[model samples]
Target: MALAVTCSISISSSSSSSSTFQSSQPKFSQIASIRVSEIPHGGGVNASQRRSFVKPPQRSRDSIAPLAATIVASDVAETEQDNYQQLAVDLENASPLQIMDAALEKFGIHIAIAFSGAEDVALIEYARLTGRPFRVFSLDTGRLNPETYRFFDEVEKHYGIHIEYMFPYAVEVQGLVRSKGLLSFYEDGHQECCRVRKVRPLRRALKGLRAWITGQRKDQSPGTRSEVPVVQVDPVFEGVDGGVGSLVKWNPVANVKGHDIWSFLRTMNVPVNSLHSKGYISIGCEPCTRAVLPGQHEREGRWWWEDAKAKECGLHKGNVKQDAEAELNGNGVANTNGTATVADIFNTQNVVSLSRTGIENLTKLENRKEPWLVVLYAPWCPYCQAMEESYVDLADRLAESGVKVGKFRADGEQKEFAKRELGLGSFPTIMFFPKHSSRPIKYPSENRDVDSLMAFVNALR
Candidate 1:
């Protein structure tokens, strides 16, 4: 026997509309309760396995106020692992429209669609088709093109819904511009500017939502996003509920091709940024984005001055690995002050300084009982400077823990030696080599605090 489920979705604009959908499938409540790993990955379940949906209590949008203004409490309940697993399976074969439908039904006013005046506007149309109350927002990076702002206005008028404009904090923007100048990204990198302008505003926007939908597609950048999943937990940012694993991010079109998105936009008469006609495929800040040649990928038009791997602006996945590797590969200037030598920098208490010959001699000490925690750092790197005090404190504390701590300066006469022996690719790359292990284990966590550093060292033992 099959169970029947009914959902009534109401969307109010200048012209109000209401719609009802009925399906003979298990309710989201049941799906949420089931464990994700238990579900088969290949196919849908039999009709007899379906469970009925019980009408859920409803609350008005006014009562569900926005949580964007405040830091979410850390104790908030996290979404169940099973719920994420089941949602992924249920939506695996679902279309973008169906995915939006399920998202709205489950999360209600708590779900938002992120718009960047790009092809992602297709998600806005899909939300409207659901006839459900939903939130739409965009990051208003101060450096956006005039055409993009005009397009935002057009989308607002066409949908008859207010698109919340999230702006960067005034103080943060002023400080960055003052310190780095307007075009410092050209000299340094796009990460710092993007963090101040784009990332911070988006984080503020996301703090109010339980789930968010983006227009990211796997084909957009195969190197960076080849395995974009239809739905997954956002690893970097948190939702209104600040608990770990509380937020769900939906990339409904992750599997959709670029051509399909364009086709839908044209078919639906969707309003788009006028820049598309000027040969710009992927639109970003005016200064950073440009028109690409016929054969270039869409992202090639963004951050065109940098290497392809460093194109991302830190809004989605961070370009940490790329940035770190670039920094270590001689992209940054090395400090050559006569005041500090490799021996002077690494001579802190409880820390042994290792040269190329010293590192080679470590192979002879393979039978040594205690393990070693080594740090390869460059003096000019800001991350290394910030971590210096904590690293020293960590060494002092770990003196009695049977773990040996050491340091190496990778910027001086030993630069080539450090690069050749340690295979250093980033400033302050930490590694742990257990006495018995043949190879060293690179520390993976970005946290540079002393407690976190000690915890990492302790866990290896």
Candidate 2:
């Protein structure tokens, strides 16, 4: 079921398309300074900033039209369910452009292209090739690289379309940063940060559309996305009328290879992020992403410290199904080998488990007999899990020393108090309580290796 809007295009200028594009293009700095907080909750384009992004000049029948396509949504609720499985099978081997055309014709304004400011610009080119009015939106995670921000500006000039930008809620961002500091995700897993910055904003953006197009492909991450269908009912997100089957996802380039995407971009002369030329294949937030080596997979460049099997952020959690070994136990900790309990995972002999009251009591002590080293952690946190072995080793080495090693589960019910007083922002926050003072010293670095942690305890103890 589709709600269509026919947009009228007009030519305000008779100048050459190239000259008009060059002259109208705004500087990258101008686009970089855009205040995403002003864009509202779901997504919106600011009227004053609209002039900087105008339609492309007239082109040949094969090029993007010089006219801009405006999309308006219908208030009608979607009630019909299409045979997405059959459609996926039929379009299993179709070209990217053909699949894009099909999606536009079927969903129109109800659908939007999810632009990642990467090679996915090819999706916009294909949408233009179909001459259909399409909507485009992106998540401004506030931590994107400078080159990506510039590319956003370039695409606006090249396509003559204003992108609807979505931003994370200010309260959530401020809370995370204020309690944990800016780079907390480096020590803990990236899930919490990505959830706050990327996934939640994307969720808000998708709520306004019935269907959304993506540039996902089987070649992107073989471990997680090996079975991406061309079209399917979105299992992860909801639409305008929010429910179980209220949304549909169209992956037009699901079967296209990465090299072919770059080829299409190069051939079409589409604007792309400058980081791609610097060996960074899969781009996300600036901190978690890096350049890959010669033979490494693109996913390797993102969250390089994490295990290969669990590379995906929470945005695409639906793509990776959990097996027994990867499933969480009753306490939400990963039950590796299907038999380990929560106690077994944090079963370091020297590390004392502190309860909420216990931690409160420790904080009230005017003078401690021995210096205390405590870790504020959550069982479900992969970052906490990643540092488990090292923390245990540190505890063992410090057992003979005067320092006392302990851990406090600061998640769930106690999270708010931990945030307010215990300096808990992300998982596994380490604090050192000195021998003569009640105040505790917080660990500042993201490095969680054994030697670094050992040095922290040794220097304090």
Candidate 3:
């Protein structure tokens, strides 16, 4: 069973040859006034104010930054010569949290960063040294093995930075468990588990945050080759604000890739993960991790069985489906900031940040008689294309008429199951699943263009 890489929104840009859209960002916010960051000296702000990011010098064909830590300001300067010294000092000795705090103090916003393993320790050390707590902190979806945990503990002790965790929402996890338990991920392979645990958590963790950072590097993967300075919109970060909001992700270690991270630790005199000396090129949760052998890419250890398509755990590199209703339309996207738009509702890149900690609604959703049409379309499917705007419009009309409308996508590896349960005949299919009913009322294969598609959807019982 080939795990066909599909996107919920397509990012049609200069680079479309590959299905996966690299994490390169095109920020639209002002450098000094980024929404979530607060920098005292010179970081800009606002939705349309992010053009001053002085991107690091490109190393090679590869150079993707992480969502965990973004470059809030590229050209920050208190004094020309003094600012240069400050940046140099930041690069030389600053904790991950310190870097984040400094950016926030300067830019007036928050940021994000992820920990694959010990490499995160360096980020932590920087945070500790500079007394700057990170804006966002997370771990991958795969289960972490003992060694990795031990190393994490060691780093916490060494740097005293309490790393925050981001996981998938329990509601979805329970839903998955009701359908398939923990072992189901193994049977379903990487993508399904990634979607349920990793991707969903990242989505929730990043909700409402302004800027996100990552520990990503283009050299890490062949897929991340054509990275750019700033991206206006991306497929993976769909359904969120402007989709082109400022990305304050900073790769302090961009110049450092494929090198011995553990060796660097020894040089820095940092406590190292004992296992690094062995062969663990990439360190993440244990269940889905392993040690990369010689003559292999760093990521070769992560889900060695799956192809590049299945390797992603969802939070980092995934597809985008832009054809759906614009997240801004329909019932009207709620006004959050002064400059609210459809992009923020959907394609915003802040990954899942689970709140309401320990409080979960376990009760199953009691089927209701209210009419609804659950959409089961892949981001890559053409049928679901351009359906977002119509859906939002329909949602708007329904709300005005006192009707409830909802959306659901057939993402991950379970589309086959959806096809079986919903009797899907083609892509971009929308089945009317009325409330109080257990199954969906299948629609016929008819005119699918915008005109009839909305009409058929409007007539759902």
lDDT of 1 by residue, 1-461 (tens): 23222222235344543332233323432222233334444345333222212222222232122432222333222432334555576667768877777677667656778889977889988887766666788888988999998999987777776677788889999999998899999888898999999888887777666678888887787546766777777767766556455567888888899999999999988888899999887899999988764324577678755644566687786213344322233433422444342224445779988776766666346575889998887654444655777888889998898999988666656667666766665556788888887567788765677888888898987
Q: Candidate 2's error at 388, in angstroms?
A: 30
Compose the digit string of candidate 2's lDDT tens values, residues 4-32: 33322211111212212221223222111
lDDT assessment of candidate 1: 0.68
Which window of 10 residues has the lowest lDDT sum in candidate 1? 49-58
TM-score of each: 0.57, 0.57, 0.45
Model 3's alpha-carbon lDDT is 0.45
Candidate 1 ranges beyond 4 A from true positions = 1-81, 318-461
C-alpha lDDT values of all predictions: 0.68, 0.70, 0.45
Q: Model 1 residue 212 lDDT?
A: 85
Give the per-residue lDDT digits (tens) of candidate 3, residues 1-461.
11222221122121222223222333322322122222122343444333333432221111111321322234222221112222423343433334444444443222444565656555544433332224335654546677777876765555544455665566877887788777665666777767777776655555434345455444555333224111122235422122443233454443344464445555778766777777776676667777763324566567765433344566555322232434422112222343333231112111121112200110113465355544555443322433545545555555544344544443333446555655654444566655555555665643443456456656765
Query: What are the runs in model 3 whose C-alpha is more than 4 Å off?
Result: 1-105, 129-136, 140-142, 185-187, 225-235, 238-247, 260-263, 318-461
